[model samples]
Target chain A: MKSNDISLPTVPFRTRGGVRVPHRKTTSTCESIVMTVPSQVSIPMQQHIGAPCKPTVKVGDIVCVGQVIGDSDQFVSAPIHATVSGKVLKIADIPMTNGAKCQAVVIASDGLQTPYSELKPPKTDTLDEFLSAVRASGLVGLGGAGFPTHVKLRVPKDKNVDTLVVNGAECEPYITTDHREFLENSENILYAIVKVKEMLNLKRVVIGIEKNKPDAIELMRNLIKKEGKSDYIAVLALKASYPQGGEKVLIEACTGRVVEMGKLPADAGCIVMNVTSLGKLAEYLKTGMPLVTKRLTIAGSAIKEPKNVIVPIGTMIKDVIEFCGGYSEEPKKILMGGPMMGIALTTDELFILKQNNAILAFNEKDARLMETTDCIRCGRCVASCPMGLMPPLISRAVKLNEIEELKSLGAMNCMECGCCSFSCPAGKYIVQTMRTAKAMIRSAK
Target chain B: MVGKLYASSSPHLRQGDTTRKIMLDVIIALLPACIASVVIFGYMSAVLIAVSVVSCVICEYICRRIMKRNNTIGDLSAVVTGILLALNYPVSLSPLIAIGGSVVAIVIVKQMFGGIGQNFVNPALTARIVLLTSFSSKMSNWTEPFAYLNKNAADAVSTATPLADGEHLTSYFDLFFGIHGGCLGETCVLAILLGGIYLVARRVITPLIPLTYMGTVAILSLCFGLDPIYQLLSGGLMLGAVFMATDYTTTPLSNLGRFVFAVGCGLLTMLIRQFGSLPEGVSFSIVIMNILVPYIEKFTRLKPKGFIKPKKESASK
Candidate 1:
């Protein structure tokens, strides 16, 4: 055969493997409507990932919106703010969506959202003031990972942080809260970007958005152009792939730099922030308000009127679902975030947390799993794993309790993205098996 | 909500491709080759295929029953193994011999090692090797195309395959169109190519192993001053490369590992064909490579992204 007939063009960037999950962003165009204030709110004291906060207010005390109801003395935690003016009813332990029980402060709303009179904009004259202001605003990663924003943004003095990656790649299915925030709160997001740039003296800022959201990409590009800082701030359109919004993946896509294992993005001279978290931070910086109300996308097969709603933090999922026309059918499963990485809620009575961006409820037809069979060793799980770890081998290691083999396979690097399980033809719970293996490794260590 | 809600882990969605669907695709891809075999070798080919398929299924069902395992014959994997085993044998082989091969494949090679996806080697190839060693003279009897359909002829005589001796060469067109004497599935280049193309299109198997294996063989054959096209079209290279060597459980996981495995199979096949006493080497080469699959996978395991390999020694020292 002739050489010309046999030569094939090679695909570029072939190592970056990820599955293309469906973008069920039904509420992307729906304007967010403020939810009706609930008669009672049970704000959990442990919403963020670090130290859980303690209740600062006792029962029978009156609290107002923007009032600090719970605070933590630990350096890694964020304080909780009341979303409505109400009488503290009780302080009791409540079950969280992940099946953990945490102390929650319940308050009966008085129908008046009384703003705290002590609210005032902080001084932004210095870097310390800006950092303290971000911490006081009680902002964490609103993109599902509840890592405290102040802790993430604090670059060590020994390291030089030069880039700020504003993650707009909402790669999850059925979640469009970030897209809506980009469209509706564009100004605040831009303000936050500018403030962050000024505060950190960053050289470059990249806003990475998936290609599925053309309007959001266009809007962000236009905003950057209007600011006349196109050279410093650029909007990059990436391929629409699941887990493209992951911190390490985004860092690689935007900067062509890899965040080494067990290292933060700062180690690669980059600090990543979610789009919605930045918007909330900007709003707080200007209005002197903390993170109380959150914009969420209520969607999935069980939801009758799937739309975007802004509800106060700690609003019961039952009340939120009722606000969106209630369940059309019996919900077989309720998730607290996007379908891929969302936490399944055991009860609808579980309260929404600060990191919840979407609440998905699926009927029996959509939620039922297939009968699992023996793995045919098709290698689809290996191909679809974004982390490049072999889940089948990891699962085998777990079955045999081979800790050394598990470590060699890089089981600790699994972020539990669910791509392996989703792409498996045998319907194997690949991610769950990896999770078990990871736990075993941890215990062994 | 009206009833108890179901709560499990994340990833509530699936790609919806089942193992049965994948096996069905493989069977569909093999159809054109089956038709070609029947057309060239006459009704005897059809009879052999039928006997092999039925016996393999029965054997698998009986074995699974004895083992108290769920019946997996529904996945169509047993049918695939039967067809592959039948296609690898000459049409002149007796029905009893074909059934024996099916029993060895399904009962001993497949079930004894656990069913589909658990066997360390391709069941059909193993049975082919076993039959070749046990009944060499009977297994080597090749018949000319359309001879069995000739009613006026007294008897069709056994003929030598193209690979048996260079003097038994036929026209390139006859060889390419599968009118020459050979195994049922290995004769027709056109039929096997069509089936391989269908497989690649449906993505039931990646083209990596087949392409690399065939490419290595062709290059090595050219270097040895042999007619590359003849070496490729003769023997069981096409069938083994396309079907046998790509068996999922017997192959490596990573693409890099697959490349290494295919290259190793190609090298071994060329060495055996050129130096060993046997005229054909595809089955032996693939079985050997299948035995090395776990090692290949271990060495070629993909390094996780952002993983830095620790240097063994300092360069300065």
Candidate 2:
């Protein structure tokens, strides 16, 4: 039995522990503006988690929009697509914010977002055909963790999935991309849910939306009922909490089935899909276009004209920031996602990937490093940890370079939610230490 | 942007909190008690508190400089310790005793054990016990309330405390209003309750330890065929439960472990007051429980929610 001591009073179902993050969903009502295509895009070969795609196009190669520019033979990887009709400027190694030098195809746009000639909706009379169609779509989990979408959807032969949990809990502070998706693309989202439910032979579907977005929840509920899928699909209003949309936390809240350690959602008899990922799938089925344009919330304290904007994949962050009225102040930190789980980029020159849902530029006041103090053992971190990880213990293990202690403390289970660090009165960088301990554990192994 | 952009791991945003901020909250919470002590016990108690705080801060500053540690007087933990140490002393004691306890607390107990969050026991409580041992006569010279109200300037009438060896217990009204003889801050139950509420409101301390500490004591006193309310409002139980036992560095971090630590404190305190030679055992029980915190946390470690039963490698950890 779990205690929901930290849950809000209005919450119907609750998970164990999560921090109360401010919902800075400022751009939820704004129309997602279609930005002007940049002169060029630097599409990296490795957009999502898996094997890095080998570049299929070289410098001076003419490529049309939606054409496969990079692909991997590995089953786990997704193909990279050209977002603009252009000539490839260069295919070379480039350093990324994630600290990896990967092959990138720099395309010089010809000012035309022309679709590929072979673009047509593929046949999907069966599950395998549907999965194959999805595999070629260059889609991944767009909810921050860029796990391949098709791989997540491919329920194994031995297991049977009963529920499809759509993650609509955009619980992060500044990111409202999913909220806008439910508002702007309701019809397609329903289509995807019903289609996936039928294809997977799932009994029910639960779309978990945070109560912060009452408009989206009401809109989704109205759509699900108007389509007469209420019996099969339920719109759950979740309490607004940080990491409420976390895979395991959402699964448990929606389906009451825990996604235990070392197990996928498939193991727990559910297929969890991000709301945008589902919308993208339905869009691909309609227009036969692969994932090229991504709509994301461009927001933060440093952003001048913060709003949701749709830009082609691989558009340089610098161009997008410039498109969004540039910085209000000298940017001290630029992130590729929300503040909690976002990747901090040293430069604004990095290309936006398929999974990127937010581009936040923070000034020195918000991005400055905290001065660390000794652990007071206030237990705020312990109580705030969504995974029940003892960050202080992990931090202690890291300081002592104790590999075995790190393993026993389950430092690997830390999802880097930043809940502990956010709540720390001492401002101890416990999550950073856990990341260090994870690296140490891996090396020791 | 001209300046080089800073980059680090995820969760770039942090809440507005500093060690100084938290310590300041604690100091704010203790203000009621500090003022109440001065009001009830008179100008001497205020002087004692001032002496302890000043000396504790100076001792910490000098010791850190001598040991070449980073200057940590800015954290205000020494200030908190000084206040707590003075609050535990009888108002009639000399100001020199406060200075000596400051040395014992800041120099010996706190800094010697690596300062601040590194100490294994509550520094103020340890200093109190050492003072009680070294200056037994000075420590026990409890001054009655309204001692300064006597128009004639004379030495204070040293009286028996409520917890002193006697069949006559002070009235419940006197105990609650702090009209009886006891430590400066420990007598005023109302003021201490207000301070506890403030700490809880500020989120500087959780209610788990304090609730369990007093609750267990009340229940156990009832079991011992004694008046639970009389047992509660009298002595340093309320003060100890609220502030000393809930010290962040010395107690267990897990919720369940805190429950055990508080229950242990309640039980030991009751047993000592009933059977042992000491009249009060709050400090002793806390120090004993503080020593067992590492062991308590080991057994009562919060099992990660991912944990599954039927462990294959049971003996390894």
**Top of the candidates by lDDT:** 1
Interface RMSD of each: 1.6, 2.0
lDDT of 2 by residue, B148-223 (tens): 8987756668888888846756888988878888899898998898999999998888899999999999999999
Cα shift from native, residue A166, model 1 (Å): 1.4
Off by over 4 Å in 1: A1-15, B308-317
Per-candidate TM equals 0.96, 0.97
Model 2 has a DockQ score of 0.66
Cα deviation of A32 in candidate 1 (Å)? 1.3
Candidate 2 structure quality by residue, lDDT tens digits, A7-95: 21223466778988877778888889999989988888988898989999878999999999999999999998999998999988877
DockQ of each: 0.63, 0.66
What's the distance in Å from true for residue B36, model 1? 0.9
